[model samples]
Target: MPLSEYEQRVLEQMERQLSSDDPKLVNTFQGRASHGLRRWVLVSLGALVGLTVLVLGAATSNPLVGVLGFVVMFVSVVFAFSPPRRGGPTGVVGADGEVRRSSPPARPPRSSGLLQRMEERWDRRRDERGR
Candidate 1:
C-alpha cells in the first residue's frame, strides 16, 4: 500500500537527514535511484546480448560463445567490485565540519578450533568450582 501523507513526510525527513549527513554518498546514490530509463536500457541490452549468445552457442554447437558470455560477465563483476576513487569526498563528518573519509577497519584472523573453545569453557567452570 502507498504511504499516508504523514508517513511520506517522515520518509522525506529521513531522506533529508541522510543527504545532509553524507552529501557525497547521497549525490552518488541519487543518480542511480532515479535512473529508471538508464537502468531499463542496461537490463534490456544485457538480456538481448545474453539471448543472442545463447542462441549462437546452441546453433553452432560451440562452447566459444558460452565462454565469451562467462568472460563478459566476469569482467563486468570485476569492474563493479573495484573500489571507488579516494579523491572523492568521504561521507564522515568531523567536529570541525570537515569530511573525514576513512576506510573500514581490517578484521581479526580466525581463532582456534571448537575443541579449544570447549576446553576454555571447561577450564573456566573448573576455576569457578574451585573458587
Candidate 2:
C-alpha cells in the first residue's frame, strides 16, 4: 500500500535529519561511480590486449613473445584486483601551509531491525485503538 501524506512527510523529515547528521552516508547512497572505475576499465582492456597477443604468439610458435604476453596479463590482473591505495590526509590547509585537522563525525546508533519495527508499530496501533 502507498504511504499516506503524513507518513511521507515523516519519512522526508527523517531523511533530512539523516542528511544533516551524516552527509557522507547520504553521499554514498547517491549512486555515483567510484574513483577507480576508469583505472579498472584500462586494466581490463590491457588484459584483453595481452590475451590477444598471447594467442598470436602461440600460433606463430614464438615462446618469448608468449611469455611476455603472459607476464602482461598477470600484471594487469593483479593491478586490477588490488585494493585501492589511501594516498594522504584530506585536511584543510591554512594560508601558512599548516594542515587543519578536524575530528570525525560521531556515528548514530544502529536502528532497530525489521521485527522490532513491526512490533513497535503493532504496539503503537494497539495503544491508539485502546484510547
Model number with the top TM-score: 2
28-123, model 2: which lDDT tens digit per residue? Answer: 554346667877888989899889889989999999889888988999999888875544443333334444454676687765788987898899
Reference-based TM-score of each model = 0.35, 0.45
Query: What lDDT would each prediction earn against the true structure?
Result: 0.64, 0.73
State residue 14's C-alpha deviation in candidate 1, in Å. Answer: 9.6
- Number of clashing residue pairs in every model? 0, 0
Q: Which candidate should be chosen as best, given lDDT against the real structure?
A: 2
**Which pairs of residues clash in candidate 1, taking residues 3 or more apart in a chain or in different chains?**
none
Per residue, candidate 1 scores C-alpha lDDT tens digits across 13-129 of: 776576556667654653444455554555556656766776777689889897676555555445445554434565554444455555654597765989988998999999999
